[model samples]
Target: MAGLITCLSVPFLSYLGLRSLPAQETAPRTIVNLEVIVVDTESKALEALERLKKGEKFSTVAAQMSIDPNAGNGGYVGEAEVASLRPELRAAVESLQP
Candidate 1:
């Protein structure tokens, strides 16, 4: 009887252990390719936006007007984990059509 009880409890304990473990993420991690043009003032940012709307190449405007160090590289900020981005930036990225 003791051996029977031990056998039953072993399976029960294993089940409980499995239940206690965190759920694994089955989805693949998302990566985002990003570019940015940082400027000191809102007006400058607006100007950049207008240029973009007018069909000016982003790399060109970034090279000429961005104050960021990456301006030389056309404001290339590199790839990032979408989950690791700031909330506002994540929202903006998510809103894009592509």
Candidate 2:
């Protein structure tokens, strides 16, 4: 009876030890600051991209052309966790370097 009890207790103690161990490491969360220029059509979006590439100021173009309510603030979307963003936006933001 004592031998059987010792065997059972050994496995139970080992199980408890494993459960108390810390979890595996996880990657750090990413945070990003974002701005956007929303437009009514693909053509308009393309034009805005062109203007930005050609040196037009972001604030100037956003205020003049974006349809989003935040246009007044130069399309600033504020800081956010990258994981919380939509999938398409997350992929785009992740591709950028800090």
lDDT of 1 by residue, 3-93 (tens): 5422111122474474343334335678987888999999999999999999999999999999999999998889999889999999998
Q: What is the lDDT of residue 59 in candidate 2?
A: 85
Report the C-alpha lDDT of model 2 over 4-81, residue by residue, as the tens digit: 422112122474474333334445788888888999999999999999999999988899899999899998979999
Give per-model TM-scores: 0.70, 0.67
lDDT, each prediction: 0.83, 0.83
Error of 2 at 66 (Å): 0.1
Against the true structure, candidate 2 has what lDDT? 0.83
